[model samples]
Target: MTGPIEGWAGPASLGEGSVLTVVGAPHPVLARLGDPVDPTDPAVIRLAADLFATMAVSPGCVGLAAPQVGVSAQLFVVDVGAHPKTATLHGSFALCNATVVEASRWRPGREGCMSVPDLTGDVKRASRVVVTGQLPGSGQSVTITTDAFEARALQHEIDHCSGKLFLDRVSSAHAIYQRKVYL
Candidate 1:
């Protein structure tokens, strides 16, 4: 999945009561995947909008979730368009009530997270995945099947909604990497 590099200045921090909460290691909301969006509620739209904004401004970020910003809703945003390798991705998706309907049997992939800054780990993930979710504002449900990096990115964001970080799924702490610079 590739697309143009539309510049979006990500948000600095999750606003108070705005859903991007960093609850310690295991948050209850993070444990449970989110529910479908009503689309009629203004708060959900606002949270989605803020999440998009946050992802846009954060340098090198391909996706973001409501839990990352403290919101507990089943909402997340993804864009792989900027990745030079996955150029077919338009790099923009606003997902609500996202769920992985299918996944390929596979080993692990190196993964990272925005909530847990400066750490990377070899987290197990499906090599391929089919996901179903709605586009924010539009209330239109879209399902896409993806593999490789796109698949990995989607799974990472979905984990955030379920309160599961990449570190939690890592097979070994020795596989984790430390960030040398802030992107």
Candidate 2:
């Protein structure tokens, strides 16, 4: 759908899927906070692969966190590429237990999640942000300072790590919009 890899409801592989299942809202796992993951662990490597793969297969998905895959670990994969709205693309990358260290400016943007695909919401987010975390499978610290769509994607993924969804941050109940389609 997004790029003719497959259909939106089916597993779309950008890399290795691990054939992972993406958990949806009200599934207890979606509300659980992630524990810090050891970047040097082999499991972490596999997680990164699975996350990227799952993200690729999903239409309009730009980011995914460990919890979305039912893993209680702080890690996420993001790629602003392949998105028409993104000009400052970061390609594809994964972070382990990333934290947003700085944020500035504010804007409300429409956001939809793989976990809650039936809805979209206008959530207020920082337009610029800095996030630091260990690189997947490497135990090396990495920090990224980005603006626009990249920052919004980071905030969305990080919120998943914190057990928050765009629905929770919607300005009001009326702010939520029904999403009849994706991508």
Candidate 3:
């Protein structure tokens, strides 16, 4: 199950390990999409923290993945609730080896990507999703069912871990738009 179709541009380059990279793509090692993590490991925890920090500083970013920051690891952070206009996400989720177990058969929505900057496209995605992942520090598996904007945000970030850019999944380029000003 996938939600509406969206598109993004390619090769948003920043400083090395500055949260966006093109070299990270096409590297098979970068696509360890979902693998378990030892939550207690300080490095893992720090990685999650750094991801969150990066996300906070990034413009219009709702989520981020380790690979986006030039770290090939199964880690990502998401917080849909950070902005007022969007539906609130339940704070931050430091996910490791996150997997979608279920998804809703519903209409698709628009999406964008930090790695693929300046372009937004219509993409089909699961309107709702049930995801399972490990939470940092607890080493416990947690499941979350989300829909609408939140679901879209999660799917986009997770795609980065698998080297799947939003542009790859876009249903059409017709809806692509320029982000004139990012707040």
Candidate 4:
């Protein structure tokens, strides 16, 4: 699936072909780890843009990863500024080859995914985190330190790139619940 990035028109205003069909649970690509993307590549830039677009249009979706859109690349975009639970307002941004450098404290919270639309689960996540990654086109090193909802969102998206789902981290199978609503 190597090619140039494409764009589409949407409320997110990113471009066409960016608001991709989010792959669902049990899809082979969603369960497979993603490869590192060349941040300087034009295609990667397009992917980043698509990711941002997809996130913007997805209700209650503050983050999105390459795997979710069926691209096996280590890329994701996040924006928690509009979230009511957001503690810190960081504007939307994209990253490739992201890694968590520091994490501390653990707490449980309910989480849902576009990939796993039928379910939501209670999972434990780090309360604070520091993530490092290459910026989309600049290829510059960017580090992010965040807590609360943003931290949870980051970890969730990064997990997708690593082939892990919130279902894998749920405290127990019983904690999983059917999602009747998505917004």
Candidate 5:
């Protein structure tokens, strides 16, 4: 289903997915830039599904990127519907070669990642953003304009696909914290 945001018809269906292992911090793949992929390729479709499945199985994970799963590809999955901070819900969707076209209203918010596992940071991100990406399977292009937590989640995942982590966005060591809970 399309989110409350206008014009997004939502993502095309990605077939069956299997949970893939999430690579932790310091993994070489996480530091390398992801390569662009053909959205309609069978392998790309499967990777989209697998990212979604892996996110689903991980507690408190709202997004996942191919690089986090040890693949250096420009792809990620996000679903922030259940988060209390989310004001715009896009449901679960995978985007290939996504790019941020516009961003504004910068603010710092607590962020974490399944790949990092042990740290959370206060990162400055746009509270409102416009992003464009191609959907897997159909290779359909979609533009999403969103705000609040969903926007933050999207930016976070996109950063992962670009080989950057939340830690990279923190202002200083004071902005980073050791995560005390994992569930």
Candidate 6:
């Protein structure tokens, strides 16, 4: 049920979540690998909700990871539904301990991160991918096969969980561009 916008649902247990401040580049949390989280844990679920809330408020943010918010955990939330480049929409969902099991269709595309707000980079990434992870609240193991922008967004967040940034993926300084409009 990973097709279109059908499968994901934000868990009700999170309640009204408070949006946390997004930490920027040079933050130590963003540099270190995130600790794996127990998906069903109350704190993890709350963190997922906060990530969703923070992403919703931040303009042009398609995904957000725990490290970006100063949490050192393998948790993130994604929703590229509103972007013009989005192909497959998963609605909005939070994943814990996510990993990409399969990927192909490599292509270079412009990417920006909430943590690195001042720059955007041309990163080579898979346009199609198969990702596996557990849902935040239910802790249900799920596999998602997606393509286009959705795939790119997933990979970006996964990299964040892995202590890597789009800056690390760029071929060189020539591939990075300063963002004129912070969107």
lDDT of 3: 0.67
TM-score of 3: 0.76
Q: Which regions of candidate 4 are displaced past 4 Å?
A: 1-17
TM-score of each: 0.79, 0.88, 0.76, 0.88, 0.93, 0.94
Residue pairs with clashing backbones, model 6: none
Alpha-carbon runs more than 4 Å astray in model 1: 1-35, 85-90, 105-107
**lDDT for residue 146 in candidate 4, whole number 0-100:** 82
Predicted candidate 4 versus true structure: per-residue lDDT over 47-72, tens digit per residue: 88888777767888888999999889
TM-score of 5: 0.93
Residue range 1-183, candidate 3, lDDT tens digits:
222112211112111122233333455644555445676677777777677667767767888888777666777878776565455355556677787889886666777777666677788898778887777655677777777788787788778767677777876667677756745
Question: Model 6: which ten-residue window has the lowest total lDDT?
Answer: 1-10
Q: What ranking emerges by lDDT with the best candidate at the front? A: 6, 5, 4, 2, 1, 3
Pairs of residues clashing in candidate 5: none
lDDT tens readout by residue for model 2, 115-170: 99889999999998988887765567877878888889999999999888889899
Give me the overall lDDT of model 1: 0.70
lDDT of 1 by residue, 40-136 (tens): 3668767876776767677778888887766677888887767654524535666778889999977676666777676778887887888887665
Model 2: which ten-residue window has the lowest total lDDT? 1-10
Cα miss at 57, model 5 (Å)?
0.7
Q: Per-residue lDDT tens digits of candidate 5, residues 138-157?
A: 78888998899999999999
